[model samples]
Target: MAKGELVQAIRLLTAERDLPMDRIIEAVQEALATTYKRQYGPTPDVRVELDTDSGEFRVYAEKLVVIETQDESHQISLKDAQQYPGEPGLNEMVEVEVTPPNFGRIAAQTAKQTILQRIQEAERDLVYDEYANREGEILNGIIERVEPRGIIVNLGKAEAVLPLQEQVPRERYRITQRLKVYLVKVDRGVRMPQLVVSRAHRGLVRRLLEVEVPEVFNGTVELKAIAREPGSRTKVAVAARQEGIDPVGACVGQHGVRIQNIVNELNGEKIDVVPWDDHTDKFVANALRPAQVIAVLVHDAERRAEVIVPDGQLSLAIGKEGQNARLAAKLTGWKVDIKKESDAGGETQEAPVPPEPVAVAPGLPLDPADEPATMAELLERVPNEGRDEA
Candidate 1:
């Protein structure tokens, strides 16, 4: 390449690739050596070096002095060595410049491929470093492409993999759609950082609360625990660190706008914000919101509670397929046995029954065994079994 053009290209590469000048220079020097080796026979002990300041590449051959020439490229006669730099002795090594003619074209091709590969590798390392320290953070991204195993989300500077297990079951993806993803893990053991991000993680809700609620971000209110069924419902237990904060009200916001935003983000999923209490009975009662709990009998030894509600509130407290009780149990870290006030005769009991199929309508899921119900009430009966957060 021409001197001016080479210098300009180097400078441009250094700026555009965000790489140091020394790295580019080193790569170019290696490329020149490789090209020279490929073009010329391997008989000579070829060595390539660069003048960093002048950007000059010089190839040399170290040939041993021999009395009689065997291989022309590897051995030099004593007379020839003596003619070159320094007085040479028998069996001594000397450096001889061996730059070949018409080799710049080969060097150009080798250098182009080498420099581009190095640039791409450097970009991967940069992206890895940037995200490795950002584990457990919530990031905004756009759906870049759909893959067979998962979706690739572009997080501005990098792309993250959203695996099938981490996706909401019923949610669909459109190209270029923006989304909020929770960064659950970062694997730096590989050449590229592997980010395991999730949209279904319970931590997503916690992070969204931190973003939407100033009280949570400022630490006035702390989220004690969260039990969630992705794409369905979430039960969050929050408490105020100090007095006068009103943790539940603060999280719910004025007329429920703050919580509504989170609900909207989850595609209209339900969220129940409950106050956290040090008292197990009170905490358990509050955790089962929109359900009236008459009493909660805590068994410290078994780490369980027998919750008794009024007869009419039995189905409400147990929820559809016992989802409400299950989530409450998970949030409190206790096994819950919800029972009617009349069933409180026993202290220790198992999980609640299915309420004798409710008697409102028969043969259909969530329908009582008796009369017809409206669609609104039918939709409200959806619940998942209490499950541990993954």
Candidate 2:
């Protein structure tokens, strides 16, 4: 490139790429030095300087001045060094200009490639710094491609990967689909900064709430805990930071608009916004929502609670597959043993009929009854047994 054009390009790069001019100049100097070494063999003392104003570059070879020259490349006689601008003395170093007559032509051939490579590196660093501090925030992105390893999302300034483990099991992604994702982390990669994002992280829900609820964003509502079964249901326990403000109501918004927006974003994932209570019993009861609890018996030493629900609410309390009770336990940090009120004599008791333990794997349905007996049969037998005992 012409000297004028080179100077203009540097200015354009500084303005367009948001890169400092000095960095580009340094890159050019390094590239030119490399070009010089390529043509004339390796020389450790060779240096290149580029004038910022004129975009003119020159190569200099630094050599030590000696009483008599022995090593031609490294040492120069005081008589020979005296010809340079700076007055030379024995044992002093002098920089001699060694710009080859056709050096500019050769540098031009490779300078563009090297400068572009350096600019790419600088851009990667800029992207990494921009996202390194956003580990917990949310970003809107479009699905770029669905690779076998993960989903690639175009996050405007950078691309992010939603690994298989981080995606919701039930959510399907398509090309060009738009969604909000949680920034899980930033990792240094071979070509660029690797942004790891997530759709199933609980933080996604937390951030979505902050976006939708004014109270949550301003700290008028504090989220105490969250228990989530991605693609299925999530329970959020919230408490008011200020008195007379309803935390649950604020998160739910007017007519449930706030929570609904979050649900829609999550592809219809169910979210339960429950009030947080300092009292363990009340907290546990609130955690198991849509299921009325007759009473709760706390065993503080064991960190367990024996919950008594009406006979009709057993299936509801246990959820379709023990999801309700499991999430309630997770939310309250307690082991919950749910039982029918009839089994507890219709009153709070220290101990109730310990139900038969059934081994159920995660994500599997819970029968709440022994094999060969359907839930209806177990329900019928229970009432009959109660009547017979009476």
Candidate 3:
């Protein structure tokens, strides 16, 4: 290629690969040096220089100046060295132009390969750095192809693996389909950056909330905890860092638009956004939404909480297959024993956990504290072994 074309090509590569010009130039020079050594014989030290702006390529044979040559390729007589640049003295090196007549073809081929390889390496690093900072963030991509182990998602600049274990059981993928995923891991690979992404991770819900809700993104609301059963249900505890902001309201958005968007993204997975409390009792109660917790008897040492709901709320709080109670326990990071006023007698019954709410009372609030009372008064409300909470 001509000098001007070579310079233009380097400029284009910088723009396309987003690599620095110096790196590309260095790769080209190194390739030219290698090519010169291979074709002209390897005994002499070869130096290649390319004017980044002018694209003027030059090759030099560097030989040590000596009174008498011991090795013809590496050493030159002092008398002969005086003819080269720097008018070298003994023990000093002198550079002489050794441009081969047919070198353009050989050097062009070698340098092109080297420059392309350099660009590829730089692109990999660029991709790795880009996603490293984005760990735990959500990204949208298209399904490129599926392998036996998992699906390959084309995430614009790179492709990521969504292993079978990380996929939602109820969700199916197809070619060219658009999908949203959470970047759960970034690992180094031999040739490229290894990215492990997921749709089933609990962090996916938190990331989606940050994306859809401005309040959550701006730090007005904080996601204190999240528990998820992929393609089934997710329970999130949100609290306002600053007073006067309704944490639940902020996450749910106007008319529940914000949460609904997140739900839609998760393929209709139900999400329950509730308030969080530092008080264990209150936090447990908040976690068990759609179920009224009359009071929570906690064993701090055991990290177990006995949640008592009114007889009427037992079924609702336990949820179908006890999903509500299960999620509550997960969200609170504690073992929860759900009892209705009737279950207080210490008998446990299996509740059918359905995907949807069954006979849930919409008006029932988590707290029934309209009437404040002392601990003794509250204990009086406990059922006689027969009372349990839902």
lDDT leader: 2
Cα lDDT tens digits for candidate 2, 91-115: 9889888888887777665667867
Model 1 lDDT tens row, 170-229: 678889999999875665534565666778767788889999899999998988888887
Cα TM-score per model = 0.72, 0.79, 0.77
lDDT of each residue in 1-390, candidate 3, tens digit only: 877678799889889877888888888898789878877789467888887677667888877889999887788899998887678999998877778777766766777788788888878888898897897688999999998857999999888988776788899899999998987667656578767777877777777888898888898888777777788888878888898998887777777787788888989989888777777877888788867777777789999988777799988888899888888887887889887777675432323222222111111121223221332232233321101111
Clashing pairs in 1: 359-369, 359-370, 360-368, 360-369, 360-370, 360-371, 361-368, 361-369, 361-370
Candidate 1 vs candidate 3: which has greater TM-score?
3
Query: RMSDs, each prediction?
Result: 10.6, 11.7, 11.8
Clashing pairs in 2: none
Which should have the higher lDDT, number 1 or number 2? 2
- Candidate 3 — which residues are off by over 4 angstroms? 1-22, 35-45, 50-57, 99-105, 112-116, 345-390
Q: What's the lDDT for all of these models? A: 0.73, 0.77, 0.75
Q: Which parts of model 2 are misplaced by more than 4 Å?
A: 1-21, 35-42, 52-55, 77-89, 350-390
Query: Considering every candidate listed, which one attains the maximal TM-score?
Result: 2
Models ranked on TM-score:
2, 3, 1
Report the error of model 1 at residue 7, Å. Answer: 4.5
The deviation in Å at residue 288 for candidate 1 is: 1.5
Candidate 1, RMSD to the unseen true structure? 10.6
